[model samples]
Target: MGLMALVTLGEWAAKVGRAETAVRNHLAAAPGFPAPKGTRPRTGKGTPYEEYDEAELDEFLKAWEAAHAPARYQVPGDPDEMRTLGAIAKLLGVDGKSVTQYRAAIDEHAAHEDRGARRYYRTGDVVEVLNSRKGFGVALDPTRDRRRTATASEPGS
Candidate 1:
């Protein structure tokens, strides 16, 4: 009679492994059936399913990690030091133009601070840009530098 009723039928068909085309046809033919709220039925543009095995998924994850491993170097402590597009470009081993594009991607609220002077990027943010990944990476805090340096300098002192 309504969208919820249609969605319930779709969910049941999905659980029973019915062909997506059949489910769509059924939904389309039903009178008073509203479109599902959050999901859109596939429009037959691309492959519907890849059907990867568990080992394939695991291998995909491993390849992703290997491709995104961070360079073995500590980032500079000052956020401002790393703020400039040129500086970020050098740090990430990319062109200045790429850095300019990255500046565009920065969250707008974070971008507008100190009259646009204090541009700070967490370590994780740099990693995300460099890795071209969706998630943030670990950020370097200036306050912790002293403790890090101290531990490095003392050979069991």
Candidate 2:
């Protein structure tokens, strides 16, 4: 029989630029993909090793490249301006209403609110708010936290 090489999930994941878990998931879903031959190190309990001859590895590499190739058609122009509220909303994976509410909250609490028909916010600010408020939906306002802490510590709070 021809010689077969064995590779671990870690090696495959590294070659494909994916996490080990993702490699396991893909292997599970693709029955046609090469199956694990045996445990690694060939002595004690270890992760299952997938059998790969030179031809199989080349086939896998070609398939991976084709799957990840960028789309042929590209957008006509540069994407929408980053400072626009709509663009910010898209980047943050939120709707216009959420962006508006965040802007309003910042304006109300801020020392000076910009006055214009089309108010613009820095992309950095929107990203910061989105990342900071991901779980609790509360802006990372140190002053607000201090006030709550002081109030709770008071005798009648």
Candidate 3:
């Protein structure tokens, strides 16, 4: 019979007032049996509890802020520019691989530009690349006066 069957039989025998030695012997002989001593049974410490003192709490907060603080390369006006690969993946409804591909496309484009001019991608380039069709899109290079005019214009309907 199976180990389960043996266990069941052993349980039944114990219930019916069978000798303790006999039930134990039957259980011990069951297939795939391990000695009772082998199991490292879990002790109930329950969930781990953490206590933070004022100094420790302050240090932890500082460390967390430093780790999560926005990098200098991020766009000045766009909060989305602060996103990491995982955050970008979540926002764009895609995985890390897609983000990698987008980065590769940007690198390739930059390489292509380097062949003709000493051009590096700005934040706008990255934005365009992310929203581009097949890694290509119309990029407008605003003149200095045009930028000033655009900035001066008030928001309206």
Model 1 Cα shift for residue 62 (angstroms): 2.4
What TM-score does candidate 3 reach? 0.23
Positional deviation of residue 85's Cα in model 3 after best superposition, in angstroms: 2.7
Best of the candidates, TM-score: 2
By lDDT, the best candidate is 2
Query: Which residue window of length 10 is worst by lDDT in model 1?
Result: 148-157
Clashing pairs for predicted structure model 1, backbone only: 123-139, 124-137, 124-138
**Candidate 3 residue runs with Cα over 4 Å from true position:** 1-80, 107-125, 135-157
Error of 2 at 8 (Å): 1.5
lDDT of 1 at 108: 33
Worst ten-residue run, lDDT, model 3?
148-157
Model 2 clash number: 0
Instruction: Give the candidates in order of lDDT, highest first.
Output: 2, 1, 3
Instruction: Encode model 1's per-residue lDDT on 1-157: one tens digit a residue.
Output: 3323223333343343333344346433544333333433344564332222323333443454455454443454554343655566677676777556546555432333333755555544554554552321212332432322222211111
| Candidate 3 residue-wise lDDT, 1-157, digit = tens | 3222112322333333333244346433544333332222223544322221323323443454455443223333553343444444455555656655556655554222332434334444454555553211111221221322221111110
Give Cα-based local distance difference scores for all models: 0.41, 0.47, 0.37
